[model samples]
Target: MHSLRPCLLFLLLALMISAVPVSAEPPTVMVADYTISPAVLQPGDVGTITAIIRNTATTATVSEKTGLPGSGAFESSKSTDIGVNIESVQLDSKDVEVISGNYKRVGSIGPGQSIPITFLIRAPAKDGIYFPEIWIDVTGGQSVRQPVPVNVNTQIALLKKPALTAIKTVPEAIGPGDEVNARVVLRNDGQSRADQVTVIVNCSSPSITQKTPSTFHAGSLLRGENTSIDMVFLTDKNAPIGINRVCLTISYVNPDGTITSQDEVIGIHVRGRAKIGIASLSTDPVRIRKGDPVSLVIRLENTGTDNANSVKATIDLPFAGNKAAYVGKIEPDNDAPAVFSLQAGSPGTYTYTLTVQYEDDYGVQTREERLQMTVLDGDATGVVIAGLLVFLLCAGAAYWFLTRKKGPGNA
Candidate 1:
């Protein structure tokens, strides 16, 4: 009974220890590293800020006053491993305003785990030194905040003047005799704003003329902003096809009340409509013969500034075998041949049409030209030759008879 009392006392003590509450070390998050793009930024400049955060706690142990009986377990502090849950992250600054990605949710971060949070921030209009604070919220209602140092450069100190750049030209391609509604986009790529911006376009080639206002006035343009100007131009009908260069003169007022100008050249492709025609037509033998193989040769010329594609020429005459010839592509001021081998039918003068087909920028077009061909009868030449020989023989016999009879009388 006395030994039982000691065990009971031990058990009571263990129960008392187990009844005590356990304590655990909470999660601790810290900023591992931070980075900012465009390390030095001017006023009104936008930049990206990234912060790398890490939970330094490798393992969290909870202390619980509890132990098992007889197995050497006693009421004492127990340790439990745990991870940290991040709820939100935010950035705050007076010299810079958060443009986007202010708050982010990072669900769970294990021990020694790190996460990267980024924010798009814009520098304040006024230049100065500033400190942006980063706040991290955890699941346990605990928060961590850190301030980041930033330097906002002044536009004057940075000497970042406004720059005008010709972004693009609309209607990249133009053809002769075409009236084009063209658009030119001008962008301000500098850190300072431009005042009283003016853009003037000039044509270097006489074949191109501006039909609209040559100069355009843009009131004001902020940095990183773009404006477009619409203009009309006419391409002369006799304009040579190639690349045409146009000059753009841009002038604007600088922040220091000085006028700055820049000149740029833009090249535009000038394409002309494809025009094809039959330059010459001839046959191998010059004259056609019935039942004989005839070779028809057609010369096609491209008179336009562009190349003619998929050129095909066909003879519509009544003949056998292939009557079509594929000439492929013909370049400007160049000619190609279309030959066909056919057998002529009957003799006599026959009128036929030569059809030329080709494709251009617009679409397919066909041209027909009337041709007069004289085909001789295969047996007519033989007949005519035989008759002429017979006539000559008769004349010779008559002449001999007359001469010989007269001479005999004289003898």
Candidate 2:
């Protein structure tokens, strides 16, 4: 009875152990810890995120059913597989952008294995606290997500340079001794705002000077905002013609409490007013007979701000000697003379055209005036004496005939 009792107890323990079902343990994968390079970042700063992924799953073994060789009986074959495969990785945040290596593939991980995954990210433009969500997708398993906290320090504001342009000028074209009004446009083309902006004009040339205050102050300028400044400038009376350059200095304070300065150049064109005219025209002899020599004189004047160079005068007449004369340069408010000798032709009255041409700073100019000349007959005195003698003889004859004829008729 004792031996039977021992056998029964052993059989009961075997049955109980065989009745329990056997199952394989599942894989466990998670993110253990993470590290960030340059934890504190400013707006538009680039940073890197590195995460440590650990697989805490033990080796899994499964049994596969196989048929026995040449027999209907079946046998069990044991097989072992390890680790979990990671399908993809992603980062989520409106303020952050993934520059590179966003989605990555980790083929498989063994039991008790850890791997590092890296990602490149850019910070937001504004300064504040941000939380970027990082997610890892596992093949045939649940997805893992983690929230990463980032501190954005924006006490030091970013600075953007301002743009300066010349919008318009009151007088499109300017002359010497003329006052010009110029409008300058300033625009903030950068992402950051500027404070306490100022502009100064530097007239390095002696020909130009500022008529009003040379400095202008603009309180604040926001991104994409624009403003204008009006300035007056006076050009010297002796300023030369062509293009002139002026320098402008701009200074502004940034949000970081720093001063920045920049220099720009502006081009201004200066043209001188040029005027030329024929001052006077005269002949040497006031009265002249036929076939007599006459001398002609012409005077030219420059009545404007620019000098007249290469002055010349020409006479258009029937009889003349050396018709053209060189008068040389005539300065502003100055005159030059040209003389020529001419022979008179057989004519009662003659008219000539006196043309004066000159080159000035602007261009070539010409002026024409009428010239009148009179010529008398050489035998005018002799003919007048002969006619007087004939008239006296005829009057004497008529007086004697009248007295004699009256006596005869009375007898």
- Which runs of model 2 end up more than 4 angstroms from their true locations? 1-172, 204-209, 236-246, 380-411
Worst 10 residues of 2 by lDDT: 14-23
> Model 1: clashing residue pairs?
62-78, 62-80, 63-78, 64-77, 64-78, 65-76, 66-76, 67-73, 67-74, 68-73
Candidate lDDT (C-alpha), each: 0.82, 0.76
TM-score between model 2 and native? 0.50
lDDT of 1 by residue, 1-411 (tens): 887998999878766555444555678788899998878788889998899989877765555544554454554555556678888889987668999876656788888889899999998887777789999988884789999877787333357788888875657677888876767788999889999999888656788878888889988889999999887777887777777777888899999999998887766677777888888978878867888888888899999877789999888788787888999999988999999998888898888888888887667988888888888878777898999999999999999998988895597
The alpha-carbon lDDT assigned to residue 148 of candidate 1 equals: 85
Stretches of candidate 1 off by over 4 Å are: 1-173, 177-194, 202-247, 254-267, 381-411
- How many backbone clashes does every candidate have? 10, 0
| Cα misplacement distance, residue 366 of candidate 1 (Å) | 2.7
